[model samples]
Target: MSKRYIITGAPGTGKSSLLLQLQKEGIHCFSELSRKVIQHQQKLKGNKTPWGDILGFAELIYQKTIEELKSPVNEISFVDRGLADMTAYLTSQSYFIPGYLQHFPYKKYYKNTVFLLPPWKEIYVNDPQRPQTFKEAMQIHEHLIKTYKNLSFNIETLPKTTLTKRKEIILSLI
Candidate 1:
């Protein structure tokens, strides 16, 4: 079976950079769908964005996430985020959880281990796609850890270090 290791965390964490490095090292990795969705929505001038219509944005992400999960990679792969992240995001925003997400068997699709990058204020920066403040990022980090724990996944919190060291930590753990 293809092992799908997920690297998830709040906005501004180094998830993308770490994943990129891993991919360059010949480890198959999946990019985060949220950024792609955000950029697409921006280009279309649509309201389906986290800052605009959060629920609508989540729905779009949900559909894409399902499509990606349906087709597993042939070898071990690392995903930028996992299904449970939507739950964390929605809950953190105090939005209603949709029925479709309530019944998702997340454990079946993800490996037992999930790596999480804690909020680091030193590296946190706001971009067009990510506008969440450092404080908001910390809150999201809490939600992500809580949701992952509730789903029975072993959460590994990556250290606040260089990107190379972070990648080494993950590779060593797995």
Candidate 2:
């Protein structure tokens, strides 16, 4: 089986940038599910959004993750986010994490060491898609670390540096 790696952390932490850079380098990668859902919802004016229905959004991302994880591949694949991310967001929102996800075997689906990108205040910006404040971003970061640790994952925090340097760190670790 091909090794599965996940890059997860708070929003605006450059997860997407790093993933895109890795993809350009010919690495197999899965896009961030939550952002896709958000874009689609905005286009359709749908109620399944983080601002409207967080659980619904979480469910959508969880399903998307399952689908991507099912595909057959020879080389190692990197996922932008995983179940732990969804669960953390849900918990942060005061939503009850589904039992199915609470007991899901995270180690079986993702690599033991998960790369967590910390929030970069210098580069952080608020866009339509990412409206969380800096404080909120930090909270999300803490939650992500807690969630991963609860799952027994080896959390590897990425350095606070330029996008290029961040990409190098991930590539070297992988």
Candidate 3:
């Protein structure tokens, strides 16, 4: 079976950077849908939160993730983020998730092994794509880890090290 891995962490923890580096190394990976949607909204509205546009963007992420999971490629695939990340965002922002998702089980779609990068304050930097404060990132990171634990996943925390070392840790775990 094709293994699906989620590379997730607090914002600015190098989730996207590591994924990009892995892709450059010829590893299959998918971009974070939330980042893509956020960028698109920013471009069209000149602001981060384009009021009345988040729901649609969230839905797009949900659909795109499912599509990526069902792709024909039979290689290991790494998702920059995962479905649990979406739920955490909505829940954190006090937005109501659709009823279907409230009862949906995400563990079935992904694998048991989940690689999480801890928040690295030393390298944390806010950018146009990510505007979360350090405290907020920490909260989200804690929430995400709890959420994944609730799903009974085999969680492995990757150290805040060089990209190559992180990749080695993940490879060894899998």
Q: Write the per-residue lDDT of candidate 2 for residues 101-160, one digit (tens) a residue.
A: 888778877889899999899878988778899999998898899899998888889998
TM-score of 1: 0.96
Alpha-carbon deviation at 91 in model 1, angstroms:
0.7
Better by lDDT, candidate 2 or 1: 1
Top model number, TM-score: 1
Number of backbone-clashing residue pairs for each candidate, in the order shown? 0, 0, 0
Flag the better candidate by TM-score, 1 or 3. 1
Query: Model 2, residue 129: what's the lDDT?
Result: 79
Ranking by lDDT: 1, 2, 3
Residue range with the least summed lDDT across 10 consecutive positions in model 2:
68-77
What residue pairs clash in candidate 1, if any at all? Answer: none
Which segments of model 3 are wrong by more than 4 Å? 46-54
In model 1, the runs with Cα more than 4 Å from the true position are none
Q: Candidate 3: minimum summed lDDT over ten consecutive residues — where?
A: 46-55
Clashes of 1: 0
Q: What's each prediction's TM-score?
A: 0.96, 0.94, 0.87
RMSD, every candidate, angstroms: 1.1, 1.3, 2.4
**Per-residue lDDT of candidate 1, residues 40-147 (tens digit):** 999999989877998998899999998998785856789999878988999999998898887887777788999999998899999999989999989999999988
